[model samples]
Target: MVLAFLTTFLATRFVTHAIRSGRGPFRDASVGGVHVHHEVYGIFLLLGSGTAEFAYRPGGGWGSLLAVLFGAGAALTLDEFALWLHLEDVYWSREGRSSVDAVLIALVIGVLLLIGANPFDADRSAGEGVVALTLLVNLCAALVAILKGRVVLGVVGVFVPLVAVLAALRLARPTSPWARRRYPAGSRRAARSRQRFPPGRRNRWDALVDLFASVPHGTRPRTATPTEPDPEHTR
Candidate 1:
């Protein structure tokens, strides 16, 4: 469980940071991405731990109950995470998510601490303790990130460290940026030309295109030719 949570924490963190620091509203995108990463990896963590506990211990004792409690705790955590994610998805979704999420998180933490404080077989309990610790760490990091305006870091903090490392590797690869620049120079110029207009009735790209095309290549406007004189006026 510890391994699982840590894995998620690291992976989530790296991704969130990458998106936050990238161009545009990448920060918001990063938050959404981190939430996704946590959901995917967090499930694995829960499954692996539950399996391990069942395989070796072999009975529905207090130990099993503890494991079940943790599993439920994780489900609650994810639900709250999802609520927050939805709130971020639409502006109106935020009305009650924060308050509800806080309560859910507090309950998860309480259960985790209770399980950790109980006496149990040292080896197995150690694993459970580790899992609990991971959740706690993730929770604290997320709160800090939200309060400090670095919510991406909090989202990323839910993933394992390896994901973050991998993200860094991908960023450092020359092919990543090179691929993005594959568009022709003319297209690039066109893209830049379109940015002047506000995104209103017309599509944003079209507006930009219109703006760019309207500008003369050289600095001067085209001069109009003089019309031929009328016969009556000339006479």
Candidate 2:
């Protein structure tokens, strides 16, 4: 899975850059006088591969090939996910950065799974009762972390239960639902959380993603404003 993901991700990035810079023979697809986004083909490929995998249960080489197709489809579809969300072409906009973040997240989870990190610890030597208890505790911690909007911590904590407990106990992100509903206005905890995880702090994560996506500065779409008529013309 990791190999497939990286292969597709890198290949897509290369092709996208080549097309954008006019260095490759590749060009944008169009059909019936309408420009077509790769995500459309990606969606179809995902559906077909998924159905084939589920119905026929291909094995060995065929299974590996299907997995590659699935990963490629996922990368393509997610690359333009922001466009689908906002119903506009924001591919190079700040909003499109969410897609990069999403891909990074998927890559992290895939790597973790490949490394044999079990969140449930079911494979351990503990008895059934102990394992059940541990699972219950970890589940609660995971839920708390998620509710507090610590998604990365929550996800990683599943593999390391202690991490979840620590994250859940920490103050929630200021703009998270947990903070909005629970942290009263002007409260000390709210202030502290805001200070610790300020909106500006997201720049660090954004920078990491920029290393991959290389978004140009000042390309975000601006809101339109109504124009005023000239006073002399109105008179």
Instruction: Report lDDT (Cα) of residue 88, candidate 1.
Output: 39
Residue-wise lDDT of candidate 2 within 85-134, one digit each (tens)? 87877665678777777777777778888898876565674777888888
Q: How many backbone clashes does candidate 1 have?
A: 16
Candidate 1, residue 38: how far the Cα is off, in Å: 2.9
Scored against the true structure, residue 91 in model 2 reaches a CA lDDT of 65
TM-score of each: 0.26, 0.80
Q: Candidate 2 regions off by >4 Å?
A: 18-23, 217-235
lDDT minimum window of 10 residues, candidate 2? 226-235
lDDT by residue for model 1 over 1-235, one digit each (tens)? Answer: 3333333333433443344334234332123223243344446656765676777765557566546545543543453363455543221123323423333344444444556632223465458777676556555555444343233333443443332233332211112232235324456433443343223535543343343122222332222224422211110
